[model samples]
Target: MTYCLGLLLNDGLVMASDSRTNAGVDHISTFSKMRVWEKPGERIIVLLSSGNLAITQAVASQLDDQIRLPGGEKRKKGSTLLTVPGMHAAAKLVGEAVRKVYDNDAGSLQQHGADFIASFILGGQVKGGPMRLFLIYAAGNFIEAGPLTPFFQIGETKYGKPILDRVIAPDTPLPEAVKCALVSMDSTMRSNLSVGLPIDVLVAKTDAHRVFHRRSIGEDDPYMMGLRKQWGDGVRRLFSQLIDPRLDE
Candidate 1:
């Protein structure tokens, strides 16, 4: 299991994901759940994935093949991540790609007693449009993040989503959103052993349409360490300040 979150704000977008996948108590491994595509000042795209390792890897590989070709097609309409028109179109392309992989592998996977589980949070901006985000399902349908719902997440979301629900607003600043993302990840790592440290974060700003900042927070990163301590202390303080049953005594 893994935890990934994507925040879309008026200022830009922030995304984070942990790097852990476990098959059983003894079969634990590390794999990245984040992917980024950028044209540097032209456009930027980031995808957070969770679910079946094989399916997710297959989808990513197909998308990577289209753009990084050394000598392949003569078609002018060969749309890769770099050339996708906008976030919405890019999202549709991702959906189609997902469907293609599912069609090719779902039956075989089931026969092997495997589940066809995978989902993605796609966020970015195209050169001519405002930033946008979508959560694509395994069935190939997707929903964009609305103004009221300015962020999207997938995989092990319940343990860490409350802080985002409470703190994130559509107009939040980029750095603040990133901070919230790390805090959310911290919450998940604390409550669930499946989700671990060494999280990848990407922050993209509007108009610049590029990955403005990227960081990997390990078990002892200063900012994350402080956040966990402060948040825990605040929670304890809140508990202490609350009236107990003995208040009536």
Candidate 2:
């Protein structure tokens, strides 16, 4: 299991993902679930993945391979992320990649009693276009994040959703949005052992066509530790301030 989130704000986009991948109690491992591609002034793309690791990795690999193919072939097939005309086209490309992976491996995995499961959050900007965010599902379908719904999460999402629901908005500043993402991830980590740390975060400022900030937050990072403590203390303090029903009666 894993937890990944993406927020699309007026200033830009923020994305985060935990590194933990767990098959069982004894079979846990850490693998980055974030993939980024950038062409500096031309474009920047970030993808957060969750679900069956094999399927997700295969989908990513397919996109990578297509992007690296010779220029003529890439253009001829129109399958490369780099050549997509806009964010919407890029999202459809990702969905098609997911379908390709499913077609190739779903039957074999099902034979082993494994369900074909994978989902992705794709967020980025293209030169001469607006920044966009998308949530791509296992069925080769996707939805774009808009004004009312400006974010998306995949895998182990429930534990982290409340914070996002309460805090995120299309006009939220980039830094505040990042903080909200961290708080949401922290909530998930506290409640679910399957979503462990060393988290990857990416922020891109709208129309910049490049990543504005990126970092890997570890278990012992001072700032993160401080934030965790403050959040916990604040929550406790808030709980304590609530009126007691019996006393009021």
TM-score per prediction, in order, is 0.95, 0.96
| Candidate 2 per-residue C-alpha lDDT over 144-212 given as tens digits, one digit per residue, 9 for 90 to 100 | 999999999999999899989998989899889989999999999999999999999999999899988
Residues forming the 10-long window of minimal summed lDDT in candidate 2: 69-78
Candidate 1 per-residue lDDT, tens place, 1-249, comes to 999999889998888999999888698898889999888989899988999888998899888887777742443553777777777778888888899999999999989999889999999998889989899999988999978999888999998889999999998888888888888898899899999878999988888888888988888798888899998999999999998776563
Model 1, position 111, has a per-residue lDDT of 98
Off by over 4 Å in 1: 70-73, 246-249
For residue 175, give model 2's deviation from the true position in Å. 1.0
Best prediction by lDDT:
2
Question: In model 1, what are the clashing residue pairs, if there are any?
Answer: none
Q: Which ten residues in a row have the lowest lDDT in candidate 1?
A: 70-79
The best candidate in terms of TM-score: 2
